[model samples]
Target chain A: MAPPPLAALHSLGFPAKRLADLATMAGLSLWQPQAGNAGGRVKPTALRVLVLLGHAWEDQVANTWTEPYTAWIEVAALADHSILELIQRARDTSLYISFTTITANRRDLAGEVLSMIGGRRRLSRDSRDNIELALHEALSNAVLHGNLQLESLSGLSVDALERFSNNLTCRITDPDFANRRIDVICDIIGDAVTIDVVDQGNGFLPKPRPEPQASGRGFDLISVSCQSFRLLDGGRRLSMRFPA
Target chain B: MDYAIDIKEQEALVRLTGRLTFNDHAKLRALIKEMLQNAAKRQILDLANLEFVDSAGIGMLLIAREELSNLDKQFILRKAGGQVKRVLTVAQLGKLITIEE
Candidate 1:
């Protein structure tokens, strides 16, 4: 029989939505267990694998042991043997690397990503690495929320979108769409192009204070990197203009 | 990853021999949580047999350390070698967690 905690994760995430994103951020997986048990104890390793794979979330790993020592043995044994790949190969700066990850290997997407650099038909190798780094954030967010199926994934989805929140200049200030995992639909008419990205995951929630941890820097990549950007209606939906 | 642990009275020595990574987060987190929950805070994590670490593995370790700290405990990582230590250092997590090489 499966452990009880796994049931909780199933409610949060399943079937997995953004796979490439999860692979980019938070990393693959790991394991943990108690000290020792009598013997033939139930294990929790399988569930963790599911979460890292973007298959599960919120569910705790299951364990069974009268004593603690045996459980730890099982846990440690399972944990001490995995080495994930250091870098991803797909982050090349050829065309627009704009999945839910990068906006433009050429144009700047804003917030935790880089802009698409246009000039030479080819891009220099040095600057291309930054695109990978930037996209890593978006990729991370997409996978993190999507995999966990947490309510926060919604924020990564359409959260933090703020349009004309500042002055009533009809200006928009939504989260950077270039790098984040938003649902974007673009319509091109003559010299004008209309684009929209809709993030499929948990919506936004308030950021909570916590101890020191790495910053989730998806929006930053798009905002700073993108040339001209704007947020619309609490970052729910936004639009950008690029000259042809 | 597999392990052989020796619990002598107050000290529970866990010998971890493998490459900790994403493939094992679930079990590892539960086991570590249980260890911190039921045993002494002064736990020995013997990584002599450890080989490599990924982001998931590192995150698990950090989480364990934090959770243990709440219990006024310390997870002593012993015998972590060459490339393994380098991975921890690059992640900057080495600064927070105890390591012996």
Candidate 2:
């Protein structure tokens, strides 16, 4: 059979339930192929990517998230292999956020994300090491403290566990500054850009008066070098503002 | 907790593996000071085998050096290649810390 025309595929339509709200909260765009290739070709709008994904390819589809203008995708093609792989590959074209959320011992994920964000990703060798270290710490807390309380995602079980995954949750509080949930705001004024991170977690633990052990200090790298940092946890905020 | 620490009591050679992020700062700082106290007035620490060092690591290094300098001690740095060295350079420590070979 001849390949379906690219224009034949129409945007997905839905019953307009809480999907829209969820999308907004999660920061993502949902697209699904509608009907079969022939049905989509004829009526065009009869089937949409998100709906088709929901009905026909639920197993092939993974959770999606969005941040501001970008929707992050977690695409997995291992199960369907040949048929669905080609379909998903042809479905979209842009920056893929698949690997960003995956936490592994390898340090490539952070580097990939920094490069994707198109910011000043070039850190000194030491800073690069520090950034990865911080990332690991954050990921560890997210997985251990946050997700550890939740049930496992499907096929992602250990021991006698069996379940499909749902939304990921994070604790609102953690002692580490780098592990805090923060919104980094970048304001560019003329030739300079001011980068600020608004965190929901507590600021640095109070400095030790009796000269504490070096191994137990937290976020020492960022604390020392980041132009300025202020904690307003009493006011429910921890802000780090620096010249970017 | 997959980490290792090696300290040379005299020359300030501290080798660390695994992570040295903010969460581990308390431990890192204490280790650094401990090494400094047992070292010569001048020291060169090697971080070549360190797997990672986060913002906390950076802070400790800077603050520790300041304290050491105040005590008339010079803590030189040595051999951190790849990502770690790049991070050090970006953090402006490449100029402040002596990067030996």
Candidate 2 positional error at A62, Å: 13
Model 1, A1-244: lDDT tens digits are 2112211111112224333343335353223333451132434222222222111111221212111111111111111122012112111111111123222111223221222222211334433333333333333333333322222211210111111112211211222332233333333234433333334344432264254342322354433323344545443333443322
What local lDDT does model 1 show for residue A191? 43
For model 2, state the Cα shift of residue B90 in Å. 3.0
lDDT of 2 by residue, B2-35 (tens): 2343445445555566655544544655665565
lDDT per residue (tens digit) for residues A177-211 in model 2: 22322222333233332333222322333344343
Interface RMSD of each: 10.8, 14.5
In model 2, where do residues sit more than 4 Å from their true spots? A1-244, B1-9, B52-56
Q: Locate the minimum summed-lDDT window of 10 residues in model 2 chain B.
A: B1-10
